[model samples]
Target: MSYVVTVERVEEQPAAVVHGRVDVDDLPEFLGRAFGDVLRTLATQHLHPVGPPFGRYQVDGDVFEVEAGFPCDGVPTPVGDVEPCTLPGGEVATTLHTGDYQRIGAAYQAVAEWMGEHHWQIAAAPWESYVDDPTVLEPRTIVRFPARRAS
Candidate 1:
């Protein structure tokens, strides 16, 4: 699918997150388990999600150090591996992807190309917010790359 990348300001968001270093091939399972753990923890604690599930990825050679969770009201107590955290707020290059998760990389590539063209420097780990339920139909995800004008 084609993506229209755009730059926009994002506000700080509080979340419950789980971090782990996972191989690219194992990312799906890792994210699944991580989100499940977070959701369960929130339910057990009577915490409600304020937004959809989100994931941040930091590439390190062949593996990706990832943090996955859902945005929620003020941080809930740490439950096992899920911890309280915040998704940074600032300018970001973003695009929406409507399709399977396997094809989401194209959206990221589009954002990277846009960043390059605009001379924007990536300031933090990129993240993807799942906007639709994957089990029902084609999912919609917003891919975001935190950035700033090159100095």
Candidate 2:
């Protein structure tokens, strides 16, 4: 599928994040537990998604950390005992990807290729936003990377 590539200035987002390197294969299951179940449970209590779940962060040591489940409109409770925090905003190179986790690298590579072709440099770690819940469907996710406007 084709992705509508563009740059967006995201505001500071309040969310809860987990930091750890999981098996690439378990990324989906992990996300469901970390995001879907968390959000679904929150929504039931009237907590709705304020923004998208951003993740797939790869640090220098290959640390795959994720900050997901944004603040909702309802009262924050101890449903799953997960607290919320804010995620700072910046310009990002966002795109969507289909299929399984293995193919994700290709999608990321595609983004890098695009950036190179356009003379844009990535300014921060890449992040993935869980658009579709992997618990019910294939591993479809949107990849976003913070970047500065190339001169």
**Candidate 1 lDDT, tens digit per residue, 45-151?**
88889989999887899899999999987778997999999888999899999988878889988899889988998898889999987775788999989899997
How does each model score on TM-score?
A: 0.88, 0.67
Backbone clash pairs for candidate 2 read 15-85, 55-128
Model 1 stretches astray by more than 4 angstroms: none
How much lDDT does candidate 1 score? 0.90
Estimate candidate 2's RMSD in Å.
3.9
Q: Which 10 consecutive positions of candidate 2 have the poorest summed lDDT?
A: 59-68
User: Which candidate tops TM-score?
Assistant: 1
RMSD of each: 1.8, 3.9
lDDT of 2 by residue, 1-151 (tens): 4555666777655555444466655666666677766576666666677756766455444445555455454445655545555554787777888776566777788778777777778987777765665554675687877777688
